[model samples]
Target: MSFAKEVKNELTQMQTEDCCTLACSYGLLLFSRAFSVSEISLLTEHSGVASLYCDAVALLSGYVADLQETPGGYSQVSVRDRQQRINIFEKLGLPVQSPRKQINLANLQNECCFGAFLRGAFLACGTVTDPTKDYHLEFSIPSAGLCEQFIKLFDEFDLSPRTTRRNGVSVVYFKNSTDIEDILAHMGASDTYMEFIGAKVIKDIRNQVNRKCNFENANAKRAVASAGAQRDAILYIQEKRGLDSLPKQLRELAQVRLDNPELSTAALLPLLSESLTKSGLHHRMKKIEQFAEELKNRSENEN
Candidate 1:
């Protein structure tokens, strides 16, 4: 389907028992824009529907803009566009317009405006048919504290967004579809809108890791299974090496690596004491890993 239609269909169904006026408005604008309708005849067939159809021609245009700018900083939404979306929210009267009512905050972030995340960040010119659900949204924030700001925002609004740390970044996943819909409603979104907010969340994360490791750099991926190994490594070290007795250097080094699984061994080099060399450092790391693996195997045997 065309990008506009896809957006329309998604928005039409954004409503649920918990949905309110604001979400409905945002959904309508998004739908009308996507379908290329000038005025929202569905709500009130104004003459703008006839003349404004021209504006609808570019409903998916902004989403295209979001795709081109990511991995680097993205272009901010235009003042006029922002105001228009706000108008939609005001008309609907979404619940989240707390500090300021009649103001929709959709499109505030690419990854998380109405709903959608991750893949939305990579959308090109056309409409992305995938229709991102929160279940698929994941993030690896470079800073845990900064990521918490978003987490709190969603939580406060009674929406659930999750975060898990990987490498040096905290990976957050917005896994609830209900929360996604609630956010869309909270933003005074129309049932017919297209959200690249998903893109912002995804890009916010990828841009962090991508700047350091892009699809070109062999795609730096870590398996979830490896996390247990690392955890076990820490536990084993503490148990066998007597985490307390292990020299301060060994304990500190292990903690840094385990805590920030994404950071390479090289990154940990500097965090070590001035007296430590890379080889000496590597040697200690190897012992921990080997011991952890051995413990894993033994545990499986006993089980």
Candidate 2:
């Protein structure tokens, strides 16, 4: 039949993760844009493709989880799929650390349901030219907590989905460029992305350091300037003997204004909580300005 039908057929037959013929098909499609042995090498910086599925899955799942909702309750197919995926750990004879909970990845990476999952995502992508237009995330969250199990399956990198309901036929979007990029990034394929390409991790780190340093240095300078300006104004007030003394509320507002010289009255409104009304925030700033003028007059008188 069509490519989409072939994907569905493949997904039906596969149960666990390893590497699949379909994933190769999927990779070929992705690589059609640009592919290289070097890209794969860079992606597997820490380990081989076969072992990094969990980390890859977690990243991919988190991306999808952030997008859409799923069915609310459990389904036989979903349950069956999860159990089968979990069975990979068992099949590899990996130790189940606890009596009830078993199938730890470290013990049995080979047993992971990864191959099937990668294929599913790949197959889904293969059938779509436009995922957003073609499908939406439609997994249901159930009271029986199928969502939890669904997340677990999703975490295995064996599945990627989007929920869609059209003509009352609920369909999950499988793969798209966005999803594939997410998957590749999850697999440590940082070099393939714009920000993460050759200049990504180092550039990001450098930019972060620059941001922190700039903020701290600028804030420190502002704090010193504000403190000096406030002190000078206070001294001028004392010297001028204006209105006996400034009130505590007025003084605090004055200090705040100097401390945040760039702050607009509207932004200052949040700090006022119960302190002022819409107009009152502006009024308070005006009061500070008038007091500063009065201080200037007193300094002039003393001089």
Candidate 3:
């Protein structure tokens, strides 16, 4: 199943008290596809969410909503009876004819009820992308007023959310991984939240390992190139004036390069006749290259 479905399934299994049940049901109905005095419907791809919606309706209004599967393979639950929709609104203490659907903060009895309400809203209209792909969680609400209320509710929990409109639906979304994880945790999906955290840790470690490997590979390439250039300078000096023409220390370093052309400057340091730091060895190599360049220039001028 998808990660979002997994989260909803986990939420559906949570145990709720009388107050939390009412609060959660309010969220589910308010954010559903349609929730008014005339009609109350919830359309979802998750069967667990559909079942939860039906259970919430039965518990809150003493009415059983019609649940059916559409041709497109979606579970749709609807209460078409006008009396039943009014009954639901009465049980939830919602206005029968509000200008637009909005959250009833009076239903959220306590802090725990807030969490439960958010859980139900998620089950109704929320989705989360797989942590392996990206960190994104959103709720698609049909009413702009309801969407704005959700944004304020998120702020109450110290979670920052952004808003946008897509296809006439108001969407409240969070892209930060921490925010998504917190939302799952608050929704009582502790197991799914732990799984998401594990995925994030693994991804972070993999990225760090890749960056370290790239750094080492680049360093190795630079070492090889530097060694190749030093070897070319030594070869030129040998072919022109010969090793005997160089001073004692320079001649010894030149011979070492001719013997171990593939070794880096640091690796060649130990093979030197006299003790020298890496910096001193580098200085000597630069001097040898300079000498060869001067000799080449003089030869060219003479010709």
Candidate 4:
């Protein structure tokens, strides 16, 4: 099941305030596919949302809507009775004549009601991505004006959502995992919210481990390249002036590096007969490299 469906299922099991539930039902019907005085209709693929809508309407208007299941996995719920539709509008505080299809927050009694309203809106047209893959929650609004209004509602709760238009529909979305979690929790899907948090923790740990591994690999590559260059310099000096011509300490360090070309300066420390700190060994290797470079430059100038 989709994360969105999971959330709706959880919502279906929760107990909500009667007035708030009615307001939520109002939101779903008003913003859904069709809402008019003569006919109130909603189409959904989620059987849970369809049932919730039918029940919420029945609770509010005292009339059960007709649920028609089509061949394409859609459940269409409609109240074709004109009086029932008018009563639903009156119960929802919607004008009986040409009411604007916008969310009226005043109908909601409290924070719980507001949350329920958002839940109903989500049931109508919201979707959330699997937290294991990505953080995304969006609502497809039918118009830009309604989209902005919805954004204000989110802002009231500090959801920090963004909006865009796609194919003539306005989309309100949030990418932040924290925002998504807070939204789910606000809508009373605590279990799904906890699951999202767990997924986020796992993803964060994996990312941290990968970063550490990449950093260590980079350091290893740099060390290998440096060790290779040092060995090459030692070979150049030995070929040109011979190791015996160098200072005794430099000669011994050069021989040790030549024998163990793969070892780092720190590793070569224990191999030396005269003990030296890692930095002391590095200093000695630097002098040998400088001498080799001078020899090569002079040979080039002479040629």
In terms of lDDT, the best-performing candidate is 3
Go through the candidates in order and give the C-alpha RMSD of each one to the true structure: 21.7, 18.7, 1.9, 2.3
lDDT of 2 by residue, 1-303 (tens): 432343234333433344333233222212121112121111111112222232223222221111112354211111123333334324334332321132222322342324433343333222322222332223222112222333354555655566544554334444444554454443332333333233334656778999999999998787566545554565566565642477766666655554566665455556642567768765655565567777678768999
Task: Give the 10-residue window scoring lowest on summed lDDT in candidate 4.
Answer: 97-106
Can you write out model 1's per-residue Cα lDDT over 116-209, one digit (the tens) per residue? Answer: 3211211111122233422343444433443555455455466676667666665656555455445444443444223545644675687688
lDDT of 4 at 36: 72
Please give, for residues 139-209, the per-residue lDDT of candidate 4 as tens digits: 98855656767788886687778888889888898899889988898888888988889999999999999
Whole-model lDDT, model 2:
0.39
- Best candidate per TM-score, number? 3
Per-model TM values vs. the true structure: 0.24, 0.27, 0.93, 0.90
Model 3, span 187-227: residue lDDT tens: 88999999999999999999999999999999999999988
Candidate structures ordered by lDDT, highest first: 3, 4, 1, 2
Model 4 TM-score on a 0 to 1 scale: 0.90
Model 1 segments more than 4 A misplaced: 1-219, 222-232, 239-242, 245-249, 297-303
